[model samples]
Target: MALDPAPPMLEPPAGDEVARLRRMAQRQWAARRDLERRLHDGAALRVSALTLRLGLLSHLHPDEARDLRTAVEGIQDELHLVLQELRDIAGRLYPPLLDEAGLGPALREAAGRCAVPVRIDAPDERFGPDVEGAVYFAVLGCLSDGAATPVEVVIRRQADVLRVLVSGVDACDAGTIHDGVRLLGGTVALGESPAGDALITVRIPCV
Candidate 1:
């Protein structure tokens, strides 16, 4: 029998496909690494800076501390904001709470940070902490939809489960939102109701 012909070499991806993929991967990896850093190094840096600033302010003369105090005070404020932002970003990076705080409070906090009106309907008592972080990101995704449309977050407590309803936004990004939900073995379903903005619905298992 004739020897089998050698397999042809596959042509490499042309133009920017390779470059685009490389860039995309870089961005994703960088973002993941940054979040990990934030959760660890970022937290450490913020705490250290805040501690040092507070110690300095405690010893300064009122006159000196006045300007330094103001500056330090400003830094302190930014530090607090950064802490919150970092928590959100890092959680968005890799939620620390799904394994720590669960589904209810995390979502509530996400709702609180929104400029758009946010209504959080949570259980009278805490649900599984594993689920809260996922819920937090799910709500975050809904709010991020249009960035301009105000969003309402309704977290309903059902029999050992949680249902999330989001409305008043045109942009609905469910993949990211679902990833958050799935972090705790929860699932999400997306839809929109007319009249004005969009609506997104998510469901999760919480006990």
Candidate 2:
């Protein structure tokens, strides 16, 4: 029997396609920046001010009797919890250290917040803001997946590419990470390590 002819192959994308992709990347970055600005300058600041005002209620009646003082203490405790939650939200929106310090410190701070212990090995080298932001958030999503497995993260630079490896955490937001990396003209691979640990590898060009 004669085999049918194969389907025609598609041509590679041209300059227009590349330009469209660049525009998409710029939009994504602009959205992230807007979110960070709103959280830092709007919601976070309001929450902090509210927390301070609630705390000052105790100082307003410092000479009150024991029972009143006890009531004020309870309110202060609740406000403290609310402040913690607000800080967590701010962290999720955009980690301050990620912008101020860099990727390494940001990852370490994120690891410290995880329920399971995480060991991170990252170089001091810095990349562009968009590149570092994408890499850091990818690992952050993995760590925030509510898994109890200990995590190990290693970040390094290979020539003009920045490499990030995350293992031992399940349920990472691989799809989201892939979208972000794609915008940066990068690649992401997810699989198991030799010892069966959940592994995620991301590579983004530093050009």
Candidate 3:
């Protein structure tokens, strides 16, 4: 089947969205740090409280004390899990290694989590934040499989220009990827190969 061109007037990225994303990213990072502090403090408090309870419960039947101990242990395990999950979310927000790893590693990590595999080929050089995020989501949009098909994403950089090509599964409107590419004042192209792969190309200036 032929892939239809993306909506001609695809929704542009709203200014509000850009501001909101920036604020949210900052808030989330702060919250993560605060949560880390709280976790450690809370754990300390819980241990103290549990110690008091253990003292009181020790006088009861041995079985009762054992049950109380088990419940306390369960609580500790749950808190630990919560703290770990929070850390993971914070770390992924703006990966620490983003500068060192460049866009390719981050894109690979994002694609790795997709239900369908996404193949990405990107430059080893680093790009600006807006350019990086644009490149990241340009490929990410395909992960939704809104058309119920798979996709392949290829990213390459030449001097100050970066190109992102996505093709596979159903052909999507150029409009579909255009807005995403436009975030960084880039251009996009959407097409499908004869063999049933949809393709999207995004070219952005790295300056």
Candidate 4:
């Protein structure tokens, strides 16, 4: 299949373009970080409190406590699940490992979470936070498209540009992927691989 044309480029003076892109990237990152903080500080805190309350159940009379203990334990188990889910959501918003470690480990963790097998070739290197975030999500958007398994991701720096290549499977929301890349002043190209699988190449100015 023929690939789609690139999205319309944003026209602005060099200084204006950089400033605009910087603001856009900062806004996107801030929104994600805010949501993650809310999840951790709100729901996660509440769940912890609930678990502490369950501990107080032991103060009741032995007969009453024994009778309710089983039920309370069940509830506690469910709350634990809720906490796990909250953390997962926070991680998805902005993976802590990404900051603690780097792009390679962060992408590897993301691939491990996928149900399908993914082969990755990302050097253990760090890029600007905005640049890394854009690249990570761009590849993630492709993975979440529910395409065929055994996807391959290759990341490298080409002079002043950071490149990410994703291959395997076919079919994705090209527009969504393009928008994410474009936010970081990057370009996204969609085409067919030699093996007939989908190929997505992303180039971002990292310098």
Greater-TM-score candidate between 1 and 2? 2
Candidate 3 residue-wise lDDT, 27-93, digit = tens = 5444544554564457545655665665566556567777776876676676666656655654444
Q: Predictions ranked by lDDT, top down?
A: 4, 2, 3, 1
Query: Residue by residue across 1-207, what tens digits does model 2's lDDT show?
Result: 998996675864576566577567757655665687787788767766876776577667767756666876677677668767766765666667877788889999888878898999998876766787778877777777776777888898999888888788773566767876787777888888887986888888776
* Per-model TM against the reference: 0.51, 0.69, 0.58, 0.79
The better-scoring model by TM-score among 1 and 3 is: 3
The collision pairs in model 4 are none
lDDT of candidate 4 over 1-207, digit per residue (tens)? 999997777776687777788678978876786777788778899999998898777556467877688788898999999999888888878776775677788889888878889888987877866777777777788777776668988899989899888888455655666788786778878888888887888888876
For lDDT, candidate 3 versus 4, the one ahead is: 4
Report clashes for each candidate as comma-separated counts: 8, 0, 7, 0
Which residue pairs collide in model 3, if any?
5-173, 6-173, 6-174, 166-200, 167-198, 167-199, 168-198
Model 1 ranges with Cα > 4 A deviation: 1-109, 194-196
Top-lDDT candidate index:
4
State model 2's lDDT.
0.76
Mind sharing the TM-score for model 4?
Answer: 0.79
lDDT-better candidate, 2 vs 4: 4
